[model samples]
Every structure is written in structure tokens, then in C-alpha cells.
Target: MSFTTRPTLQGTFGMVSSTHWLASQSAMGILERGGNAFDAAVTAGFVLHVVEPHLNGPGGEVPAIVATARDPRPTVLCGQGPAPAGATIAHFRSLGLDLVPGAGPLAAAVPGAVDAWLLLLREHGTLSLAEVLEPAIGYAAAGHPLVGAVGATVTAVRSLFEQHWPTSAQLWLRGGRPPVAGERFTNPAYAHTLRRLVEAGQAAGGDREAQIEAARRAWGTGFVAEAIDAFSRRPFRDSSGRAHAGLVTGDDLAAYSATWEEPATLDWRGHTIAKTGFWGQGPVLLQSLAILDALDDGAYDTASAAGIHAQAEALTLAFADREAWYGDSADVPATALLDPAYARERAALIGDRASRELRPGSPGGAQPRLPDHVRSRVTHRVDVPDPTTGEPTVRSDGVTRGDTCHVDVVDRWGNMISATPSGGWLQSSPTIPELGFPLGSRLQMCWLQEGLPASLVPGRRPRTTLSPTLVLRDGEPVLACGTPGGDQQDQWQLPFLLRHLVGGQHLQQAIDAPAWHSLGVPSSFYPRESEPGVLLVEDRLDAAVVTALRSYGHEVRLADAWSLGRLCAVSRDPATGVLAAGANPRGMQGYACGR
Candidate 1:
């Protein structure tokens, strides 16, 4: 039953797995230095920003699920920034735009990743700020080998950068061309930007916590904020093929900070699953699981065709609810939507045929009010050239900043974390001269209309696609796992969860299994589109299974084997205090390290 090409790495001290090897190495270095899991994770997070610029950047946002040794309960660290005060429906419409452009200053949200990482380190880490940031600074200053995907992305958008985003041209283009794959690439300006944070921390002249606070202030109200404010007035080209100035100002940056909240949880089959609130798509997995859990166990066997059908049908229905109900606004009926009784009722909708219709049921006897954008003409412009690949990875609008990355960490102390860090890709917007990074286009997830919870509003966080998962057994965290597939983040994670928790598969075995996601719901990103009755499954499945799925009226598309997900998972055994980790082999960029 093992599909994994590599065995899971097991250790007793610490474990870290991430989308990039350098990031994984950086975190392991901290653990070797006697730092805790929190310190190791934050270190990896920063390294990912420097090494995976096409996938993420320092100006990006990260929504993480953390369980500290002191506070064993899982909680979400909300790094997803809100829209600027000046970003209003009236102004966007005045610009002659029906929807915000995906990659431009106009689509930027206040950068929140820096503050969020610092906040986590300050509260739970045992390492000094200098210690944690040293590796990232070194790589950005000296150089790191660029990956092929980044080079391809840069080449694809090279002309755009040269024609309009001159700053990006100066930073990314080496010899006026995209850097060659495996070529040593350097970003001195980004190095300086990171150095400034270190200096600000040292100037505080107190304990580690106080120094971190000082750095956070410098990022929010000091130099970083000033730089972002000055750039807001400069117009730039966007995905809409129009140039427009962004509205984020210094005050917007200064007024904002990342916060911590208890995670949304669901208990079934003796294990507790933790996820971010409706503000993210984490609960879609919860709702889907609820539907599957209510059925006879054998009916959802992932290895069999029947199981795959049940999972896909349940996800289609649940994600329809995501389109119809999930959002960041207070108007979301999260509590009622997560109720078991409601989940059972929703489960009844699953049938033999692949559901081509968008069906969101009433929760607590209230009708779902979907946004006008979703109900409008659903376009078929997919960002990816084929079913196997695309920007924002698997499921999102054709318009987006770029793709995303993920990290998972666990320590001997039982602390575990799963984090998805994305947005503000180097290709998203022009690079700030001194900061060497662009603003995030996460605001594209918001709707322009009112009434829906995801309506565009100043100071409200967008319904982000960055999701991480933490699973607990008997009220203790046992696993921290996630991936980088935009709207498919949770969709891809669902099969792994079921295979591991219920199907008795090993962590790596589960991760290596073929997976699929429905594209029937409205995308979270701008220029949203949906394909009815479409199911993208890995080609590794048996020909009979593929044909069976097609017989169910699904427009089955064969995805390249090992091309579907970039998933990584880390597990800890409370009884023996042993830690095990696994990393995806699909991209050949992910790694797991522990000792």
C-alpha cells in the first residue's frame, strides 16, 4: 500500500519540511543550535522568502497554525493583511475597472509576513532575532542557486517588467535576461532590507521579546511603512492591461498588525482536525470531511473508485458553500455552518454523478447569499496552459500574484506548526527600490459587492487561499502538514488526511497517493472562472478507475504523474517522543531534515 518513493525521515530531536531545500536546511540549522520549533519555523519562513521569490516574497502574507509546548492547543497566527483605507469600490470603478487587476500595486494589501513571523518568534522562540535571521541574510547577500520554475516565470513576464515594471527588471534580470536555472542569484537590496530589521531589533536594548517588538514597529510604522507609502502614488500596469496607482499608505501599514486566534476545530473518528476560520478555505476540508464521515466508512475508501467519487462529490458540494458562504467578514455563520447536524444534511446531496451544479444549502434555516460576481458569466480562461499546471498552482483565478509555498515543523517538546506563506511574489508588482520587494495582491480575493461576507471593505482581511493544517489525537497535536496549491490547498490535503488517519497509510504513503480537486466553485482569486463536471486526477490511477470516474459524467483530465501537489508533513509520537517527517518529490525542490 506504500506509494512513496522515499521512506519517512524519523528523529527524536526536531524535524522540518518545506517547499525549498535551503529553507529546510536553515530551520534544521537552528534546531541544531538548540532552538525550539518556533525558532526553527520562523527561520525557515524567512529563508523561503529569499530563495523562492517567484513563489513568495518578504512582502507576502502567511497564515500559520501553531501549537507551542507551553500552549498545546492549536491557534492561528493571522498574517493575512486587510485592504487599504483608500481601496474602495467607488475608486476602482472610477478607474474603469470591473474587477481589480491580479498583479499590480492597485491589488496590493499592506505587507504582513514580517510582523507575523516576529510575533511568533517573540512569543514562543528561544533564539535571538539575529540568530534566526542570519541564514536568510547570508543567502540574500551572497547568493543562492535559482530554481528552474522561477527562471521560467521571470522569462514569461520579462517583457512586462522591462516595458513597465523597470524596478523589477533591474532586480530579476541578470545581463538583461532571466537568470539561468541553477545559476547563483543575488539580491543585495533585499539583503540590506533584512539587515535593517536586524539593526532595528538591536537598537531596542532589552530582552529578545522587546527587541522583536522594536523590529515589528520598525516594519510597521518606521522605514518599511514609509517606503510602502511613497510607492503607493506611483501607477503601474496590472493584469487588466491598465496602469493605476495603489491606495495603500503609511498610515495603513502603521495601523495594522498580525493577531492570534483559536483555530476552528472538528472532532470525528477520535481525532481532532484544526483549521483557520472562514477567512480562509480550511473549513472546506472540514465540511467535506464531515460529509464523508457521516457515510459508511468503506464508502469513502480512497484507493477504490467509489471512495474517490464520494470525496470529489462531497468536496464539490462543500466548496460550493465556500463560494456561497465562507469569508472574513463577521457576517459569516461559521458556527452554524460547522454544526454536525448541518454537515449531515449537506452530506445527503452526494450522488453517483459528479455534481456539475453549484449547491450551497441553508445553515440554521438561513439562505446563502452568494456574491453577484460568482453568479455572473463564468469565464473559462484558465491561467495554466494545461490541466497539469498554472499560477497560484491548482485552483484560483487566471489572474493572481503567483504561486505559493509551505512549511511544517515539529520538535521533541511536542510543539508543531503548519504554515502556508505566499503572495507578494516578485512578479506580482514592481520592486520597491530600497525594500527590493513588491506589495501583495491578496486583496484580489475580495468581492466588489456588498452583503456577502467577502465583500470588499477597508480594514477587512480577504478570504485568503493560504491554508495550513494541524491534527490532534486525544487533544494532543500529532501532526502538522500542508501544501501550496491556492484553493486546492485543502482539497489536496483531504485525501492525505483520510488515507493516513483512517486508511492506515504511513505519512509518506498518504502524501505520495494520487489526488484530485473539483473546479466547480468560484475561484478565490480575481478573474474567477469555473468548469462544470470537471475533475483533474493524477494519471497514475488505474485506467479502470479513470474510466469509472468518467462514466459518472466527470470530464476527467489526466494530470502528469507527481505534478499535482507540493505537500509536506511532519508527525510526532507523544508516547515515545519520536518525530517523523516527509516531503513531496514532485517538484524536486522540497526537503525534510531532522536528527
Candidate 2:
């Protein structure tokens, strides 16, 4: 067998994988206690918030894909909060802004992850709301060891926190200083907030579903909403170097609810891949897969320079289409874009040399329109001063690390889920002292320009980068995987899928393989810059491979040997009732547990 950082966990019972070891172990405990996959996933999701506070919090968002044994078809759980009713292009234009501020309340959407988790627990989970939330509350109330990266992230934004948002400094700093790595940190305020929600549910009576609904209500129309609304009224400094009051009101929170939707799917090589709809960047993967499927089998050779060139070229085309065609608007030509004919036509564009232009294709003979901002600007410096200021993977120090968390769970009953939870970084906005967290800045993904499919609009979900994947064979889910790299989420996942599904590598071996992603397309985060014909690869890749890629006219850049992807995955064998899982080793945090 080929070398791997760790063995792919194998078992007949249950499996859990996530970006953090504590979350993976806690979820495994729930499964060992006889809770189903949905219950375990919910438990892990909440625990991730408390343990990985620099990455995610109660106010972030999650988009997940879930499949149950009784209902094998994949379904999407959309916890992505929409832009508040007051968020509009005209309003932003009046502020003399061409882009949404990347680090303030003005960039926040209605908080949605908490409600979505509660909804899943109410409908699919067997555990009580309090039971699923217990681990997270304990971690927050007691303490958890702070990781080194959290300290580095805090140090990056220490000055900003002290000079502008004192509330944030008050929550993240220790005795007016940055916390050291491995220190035991506690957020008693967040523990109290969760305790209050549980109490509200218990007061509603004995029915579990009613209790969960009560907690959801408490978040939306109750104390949670009240705290956020009151805090948003105060102007706070942002990436724009100006203080602005937020657009999210309690009414907007009251009007929001997490909902379920059908997944967008594609069939290739006898397996079906499912993802969130066009509103997210999920379709970029489907589109890339389609483009690759039309090419020869040699394109699947991830080790070859020719193979890498083929894949990167295919991704740039799909990303171009994503920028022009994918959005929450009714005008997104979803069907036409995924058609086989269109895929073949797009594949025909790839050649021996790299093309340095953004090429968006016309679907169904209609003209493609890109945002004028994307077309006019070549590059701009974005002030992502800290992990919270929009792009978590891209830091001001030039280090590329995932500042988000991911979890995957699969039980013996065949229930499986893959969820990517992100946003509400401790540095995103001023922390609400009462709630112990800040609002998310997801609205920065939307352009301030009007009439575009992804323009800022009230009640519209900002096109997010939190994409998760669920794969099925013969109508049963076999694999679930996801990562946290903002715009690079799907791009990084593509290579893993190709290595495992097409190249016949085992789960851990596939995840351990060197990974790369093209920076030729526009980034989904703030500044929205693009580097045409650029490909970033891990330095561990074969020297000859990198040299050949450059010879193909690609602008190749080498990153740290193990600093590209943080993929978490779980898989189940349908015929034999066996399960397996793998987690990324890049950050020394991701772990997989099973028995």
C-alpha cells in the first residue's frame, strides 16, 4: 500500500471526522451511546463552535447535505442567513462604497447556524436539545485548550481590537493581553447564553420537538435577537476605516428561518455527487466534474504535469461560469449550464498552453453577464487583518490556513451528513458582550453593484463559499466530505475526489496526496481579486511535475509542504455494512474516530 499520514479508520459501527479532535471524540461518544448520525453530527457541530472560537461561533452559518437510510436521496440543510431587509445596493452607494465592508456589522447577515442545527435536531435527531448542546456548554463554561493558530490570529488583530472594538478585545484578550497557546480559556458568557436557551425550551414543556422550536424561537425572536439588535445600533470601525451601524435589526432576525431544499446533482463514473444549489459555490464542483468527465482518462492522473494542467484549466472555466451564472436570482440558467453538450463544448477550449483570460460561456444561447466590478478590476489589496475579517484562509502574514471547521458523520444505519460551518470569527466584528460572539460578515460576498445576479438585496442569500458534498452509489450515500477555504473549498476538494474515485486510492491515501488550486478566478471574499493562470501547489509535489506545469505556461507557486487543504471525510460500504473515515493532517488538529 502507498504511504499515508494515518490509516483510514475502518469499522462496522459508526464513524466521525472533523477539523478538531475534541469534536470528533465527542461525536463518537454520542454514537457509542446509540444516537444516530444526525444526533452525532449536531453534537459535533455545536462543540466545534466552543472549541474553535477563532474559526466559528454561534452567529456563523452552515450549509449541509444529509441522507438517511429510509430516505436515501440527499437533501440540503440551508442555514445560510440572508442579507437583512435594509441591505441594498442603493443604501451602500449612498455610503460612497463600491464594495461591502469586510469587517463590520454592516457586512453581517441574519445569524442562521443555530436555528438550522436546532431544526435538524427537532426533525431528525433523537436526543433532546439540552443533551446535544451539553458538550458545547461544558467546554464553554469550564475551559478548553487554545490552539497556537488562535493565538497567532489574535495577535494579528490585537491593535485593531484595542484601538477600535474594545468589546472584541474584552472577549478575546486575557487581562489586556493576547492569550498564549495551550492556555485554558473559558467563555462563561456564551455558556450562560446557551443555558438560557435550554431553560426557555424546558419551560415550553415535555415535547422534544416543541422544546427545540422554543430554543429556535428564543434565538430568533427572543434574547439572542435582542442582544444583536441593541449592539448593532452602535457604529463600529471596519475594513473601510470608518465606523458604521449595522443593517441587521431584530425584525430581520424575527423574519428569518432556516429551511430545507433539494440538492443539485451530477452522475459520473457510476456514482452521483450532490451539492447545494446554485446560490452557493457548490455547482462549481459539479461543473468542473462535468468538464473533466468529457476529457480522456489521462486527465485523472493527478501525479502528472499534463493531468494537473487539464484539471486546472477545467476549473478556471467552471469558475468563470460561477462568477457569471451562479447566484440566488431566478435568472441563473442552472439546467443549461450543466447540460452535457455545454460541458463538452467548454472542454474543447483546453489546449497545450494556459489561457490567461476569463472566459464565461453562454448557456441556451443567452449572453453571459459578469459584474462590472469583476470585469474592470484586476487586483486590489483587501485588509483581512485577522481571521474574522472575511477570508480566513488568507492571512495578512501570508500564511494560508483554514480558519473554519468541518464535520462528517456516518452511522451503521446508513445515515450520513457533511457540514461546513464558518463565519463569526472573533475578529469579524465587535463581539456582543451579552452573547459572547460577533455577527458574521457573509454579506461581503455580494457585490455592491445593482442588476447583477449576486447584487446586494434584502432577503437574498449571499452566494457563500461554505460548500459540502454528499456522494451516492445505487441510490445510497457512500461518502460525505467538505473543507474550509472560502473560495478554494470546492477547488481543493476536486483533487481528492479525483484521486479516490477515479484513481482508486484509499480514503487516507487520497487525503494525504499533494493538493493544489488555481487562483485564476475571482475570490468569493472581500477584495474579489483574481490571478489569471496562477496555480498554488504544496512544495511536497514532485519537482519535475512543478517544472512541467510552468513549462505549460502556468504561473506556479509553491506553498508550505503541508498547508493547502483541511478535508474531513466519512464513507460507508453499502453492500457489506462497513464504514471508514479520514481527516486532514496539515493542521495537526483534524482527526477521525471509529470502532
Report every candidate's CA lDDT: 0.85, 0.87
Clashes of each: 0, 1
Q: What shift in Å separates residue 300 of candidate 2 from its native position after superposition?
A: 1.2
Candidate 1 segments whose C-alpha is farther than 4 A from its true place: 1-3, 381-383, 386-401
TM-score (C-alpha, index-matched) for candidate 1: 0.97
Off by over 4 Å in 2: 380-403
Model 1 alpha-carbon miss at residue 8, Å: 0.6
**Number of the top lDDT candidate:** 2
lDDT of 2 by residue, 206-302 (tens): 9999999999899999999999999999998876778889999999999999999999999988999999999999999999999988999888788
